[model samples]
Target: MSLFNMPLLIQDTAAIEGDMGMLWMLISGILVFFMQAGFFLVESGMTDSKNAVNIAMKNFLDIAVGSLAFWFVGYSLMYGADMGGGFFHWGGFIFSQGAADLFFQTVFAATAATIVSGAIAGRTKYTTYAIFSIVMTAIIYPVAGGWEWNGGWLNNTDGIMPAEFIDFAGSSIVHSVGGWAALVAAWMVGPRIGKYLNGKPIEMHGHNQMYATLGVFILWLGWFGFNGGSQLAWGGDDATAASQVVLVTNLAASAGAIAALLFTWIKNGKPNLGMTLNGALAGLVSITAGCGNMSEGGAVLAGLVGGILVVLSIGFIEKTLKIDDAVGAISVHGVAGAWGTLVIGLWGVDGDAGIGIFNGGGAAQLGAQAIGVLSYAAWAIVTSFIFLFILKKICGLRVTEAEEIAGLDISEHGTIAYPGKRQREME
Candidate 1:
């Protein structure tokens, strides 16, 4: 389907499936909202135990603050009527859109902002990160999202290009935006203390493998709504499309996990659990953009690539680039998101209709996808850098060196994730 031609799912209560569609959207939004918990667990488990409480606080603020920011300003800028000649938009402020649309997209806004949390988890000051989340949801993410979803220049293909940009559920518009921001945040925050000793990356293992594992599981489930809900309706062809999207999403995730598990085993002689968990997330993000357009086989291929790329990207970012990402968020979301968006140009489809170069489609679709990917990356990196740099200069971004040793849980927030250990020490 053309990006502009996708169903809007506006209320048509007289239709037989109107209620069903509305319910589907609400349920999907709930599922996506629940992914916040998944993010909380993933960030906490992957980082130091001492910072778990602080990490949780960050996640809490991400949704609480992000939702309001998006609602008050970002939503209008994104979904409102175009007012910037295809760049800026203005709707009535304070979320006048349908409850379902607002609810679903609110979760997505929160999600994009929260992706930065894991990358800068252990070291960033909560106040700095909190303001960054507001800007992310209220401005950065919304502006990029408007370009496509709101029929900005990217989707104005009739006037600007030969084909439309496709991002069924925002691999680039959401995940890549967040992913790139995570990279910048991590860079600005600098590596966690002791992350690099003598310029060599040291192992900073997560405290709880089970938490990471379960977090991925929750995110995996949430991806069904993330992709399927993009269908925007449950009646007739929309139902079929939604089901197909869910199927492809599942296939891609499974393939991604298996690929990572095998890749780690072959490379290191150990089936690393962490790689496997992130592999699943990489798969979900990979197929998110093309799930509606790709066949089952194509989805698996994309997911496998996403999984492999995440592992490689993580290594390059940490070891070569010397950026410390607490949980590989940059690789899983940003790098994999770019790959997912570009791969659609290679092999995307609409049932039997071809929309990909390798599948009998022309390069127009590919070109559009490429532009969208680059646009998202550029927008995210530049905006996040501007905000974080200013924050860094004005007040500060990271915790004190003493606080680094003390851990943010105690220094930032007077609490411990595992109070028993502290209690034993005091005794």
Candidate 2:
């Protein structure tokens, strides 16, 4: 059965394609896994100095805990054989057949779970946070993912929706699911001590803006794989499609950063670094859903809109809603993600149908995208609320008032991120 002895015709053409796909998936998965580092840096840098180690620990634990949870249960719930009319998968628990595929998906699951950590940082009990991570990876994220990615009703070609919901690379499945959960979790957990003073919000600037900037850069680099690899194939046209996705993804991120910079400069009379960083992320999230199907121009527009939206959304969430998201995770991921998904209806280009309302495809795709957004939002928010409520009742979600003042690095992890610096007194 040596290859040289085998007949040329007997060798499978599809097998070669499969091998290429696996290699691409593996590389992309590795890239996505590195995003955890980006998250750690971003969250830690955007918050107080004392909580840096604590934030880093949670981000690290997300990958470790999430991988195991997804392997044992989440993968099955998402991609296993469909059962109960596609509401869930019946089997495939603890499975290992497609190693590359499993690895690729595990990173995505971890990402969804980690998004919540940033929102609830500093105040959460470590034990409760660990449990939340497991539940998100093993249940919440997987179930929401199953709806579209695993051939559930949302993306079902012949479902009740006007057209299939198109989330090219998980704008809704990964980002929005994470975002909505973050929002719910942040709201339920309440604000950090001194985040609001006398019914007015107070600004708690991050300890290290340099770390946040570097983290944003790393996340931008990782997004190439995040969107490009969603093509799921690497041969012929698939290769071309993937390359285009990477290009547009970059364009959108750039446009978003510029837009946010300009907007903030106009509003604040100075260019704010934090808003600029968030703008770049907003653009990336905005274009993720439609990257494969959008023109470069459309991507630019999406990014521009996303960048502006993020700034406004952050203000609204902070001022009007009074929700304290230490890193603006909910606005950047949830709000921008929803916009990106919905934009697909206006900008998407695929097949003979042309796939977007402005592209002569009518309102079918738009309607579907809307449905997908609302559905995922409801699911994520409700499930997150229930889980957080239960945890709040059973274990109490927050540390004591004394713990809040002492910093989680000392109270939770028994060490300080900056060893010698005097602990700043809580205002």
Candidate 3:
């Protein structure tokens, strides 16, 4: 039918999609921004109450310090003109016209920085963490992210990649970067005092399971925007793709939570609330890479596996590796992020055909996924290790043993999260 005869609701989205996209980005940015509160709650509630205020301060630092760094320098490095054949860039520092996109991406950089906070909670020096937060948001994160997101060598067009590396909502870019850095920070800071004694692990339960549970619920609610808004548009085919992203995201999270709940119930003779919460987050991370290309069944499968894997991974990191990750950030984000990225090569879809090996695609896509996964791991590990090593040697990465024993809230922040629960000595 002619446009003049068409109904008002039938206008092509292309006529209005630009504005729609900006609106969506702003909405999504707000949602992603709220995740900061979620992180604060989860990290605080999952760790000792004595350290709650310290955790609160670190989370506060991540968004506050992290955002300014991303704005002034990181964005230019990531989105400015490529300077060294995708390895370097310059210009656009503290400047940009695309405000909506800029705000959205800024939140992601903050999210990456905050992951380290939970892992290093309690014993790490707050000033050192504040510095690391700046380093991550500015240099370490942006440089690696530029490689793919900014059309750098790792992207398919570089002629080095065997296939396109897909990470629709940043399972690898955002989550894994934070996860691996957390791994290094946890290792370098050296397990929390008395976390282990003579080669045996000790259980350090989080002070407030109720708060942790609430935190997970908030994060789950935010994922809808995190995944859906990644489509970067709001009409035409963008509409359908965004809808699918939301659907798959939810399904994966549900499956992840269920898998963890069931597994712990069977193995531990009861459901573990902590593990279950992490499982849901793992599922969310797992589906993030493939959400745009996955079917409902694929999303569920990925999340279920991610959920089970997180439980196993947490145990191995804590007991076997002896890395004292207070909130299990490494497993739920890093390990699950790698799995999420790699699963695309196993059963991910392209148009109507599967891009994964089991779906009739060759090993090429899998190879690419593996390469991307390894590249991120190595980059995050090496850079974070060096930075943290320096911070440890020069400025001190951890609190004094006495300060740790006293609890970071009192020792570092000069306050407590729950003052009523503490004795005068604790204060």
Candidate 4:
């Protein structure tokens, strides 16, 4: 039928519908873009005072380098026509599949690339970090993303989870991927000087709590987009799903923050700001995988569980494993990502609940989630080790002891972030 002959109600409604959907997607994308700043402050605040500026630079540079790399190759490797028999594929170069999808994927690509910066914060050379950023965006992250988000093996119909596996956003694909890489990088780089003493733990303090808190708030704000944008529609079915996703995401984060705060208060006899802050993040990470499909109540349960788990896991890693993760990135991202992915098989409530204990399903989905988590962890650890080892051989991943002790702010960048003269190295 001709447009002039079409019914007025149908035509008017369709126009409004299209406009609203576009608006929603655009706004969500913008919010996700802002998260880069949030991550910046959080990482910067977690480091020693001597290296704040250097940390900030690494965060910024990762985005810059990551964006370029993703634009050139990563997007295609991830979302282009799948190859490598659905295992892994190398797609063509820059601007593949046009500009729109590349821009959207670039933000996510950079986030994954940025995660390692926190773990290696105190000792990495700027040049080394920059190079690794490119590798992460162009190779490591894209290949992993292909397996899940882009219809590779993890998300394939013949795959492990198949009918039951789900990740609405990227709890496992993004956060866990980043965390796994961070874990390996930290171990390879070794602990910061004086972080440990003959197997004893030493306290390390942040330079600016104020900046870190601000960063947390920013991250919280950005999460709406992070989860919502995954719907990929501005309105109608997509928008409806996006709204539900945002609601669940917020609930989980809130519950996580509360649970973490209470846990710390009882254990330490006082409210711990850092732990509280991380709790909120823990909730967000835990919900990322299932935000689109979970009920409000399910989100709360996931958030609380994730927050508490993050606290315990961080302690275990630091005390038992003795991994020197400066900002608790590994625990908050890796552990929580795994939990969130599994939680979906339990509490997911939308049409695509997959399979869940709550929905009369047993351990099938859970087993699949576990496989996905372990596979990502193993792959990330092995590849990260190989990548860093090569970097060490060729250009040295770590700075000299003198440079580390002096602090990267001045030693690496030739400027003290703080105004006052600095104290001597802790030794």
Error of 3 at 371 (Å): 0.7
Which candidate, 3 or 4, has the higher TM-score?
3
If ranked by lDDT, best first, what sequence of candidates would result?
1, 3, 2, 4
lDDT tens digits, residue span 167-220, model 2: 888888899999999999889889999899987889999999999999999999
**lDDT (tens digit, per residue) of candidate 3 on 1-427:** 2211111111111322578888988898899999999999999999998998888888888888888999999989887888987777766669554888788888889989998999988899998999999999998888878877777777754577899777778899899999999999999888998899899899999999999999999999888888887777887767777787898899999999999999999999999999999999999999998887777888899999999999999999999999999999999999999999999898887756667887777898898899899998999999999999898888999899999998998999888877778766556
* Superior by TM-score: candidate 1 or candidate 2: 1
Looking at candidate 3, what is the lDDT of residue 422?
Answer: 79
Looking at candidate 2, what is the lDDT of residue 390? 97
Off by over 4 Å in 1: 1-17, 158-160
The candidate 1 region of ten consecutive residues with least summed lDDT is 4-13
lDDT per residue, candidate 1, 314-413, as tens digits? 9999999999999999999999999999988988875556767776788989998998898899999999999999999998998999998899999999
**After TM-score superposition, what is the CA distance of residue 365 in candidate 2 from its true location, in Å?**
0.3
Error of 2 at 128 (Å): 0.7
lDDT of 4 by residue, 335-424 (tens): 899899988677455453335666655666667677788888887888888988999999998899999988898888998777654534
Lowest-sum lDDT 10-residue window in model 4: 3-12
Number of residue pairs clashing in candidate 4, backbone atoms closer than 3 angstroms, sequence gap of 3 or more or interchain: 2
Model 3: residues with Cα > 4 Å off, grouped in runs: 1-17, 424-427
Clashes of each: 0, 0, 1, 2
Top candidate (TM-score): 1
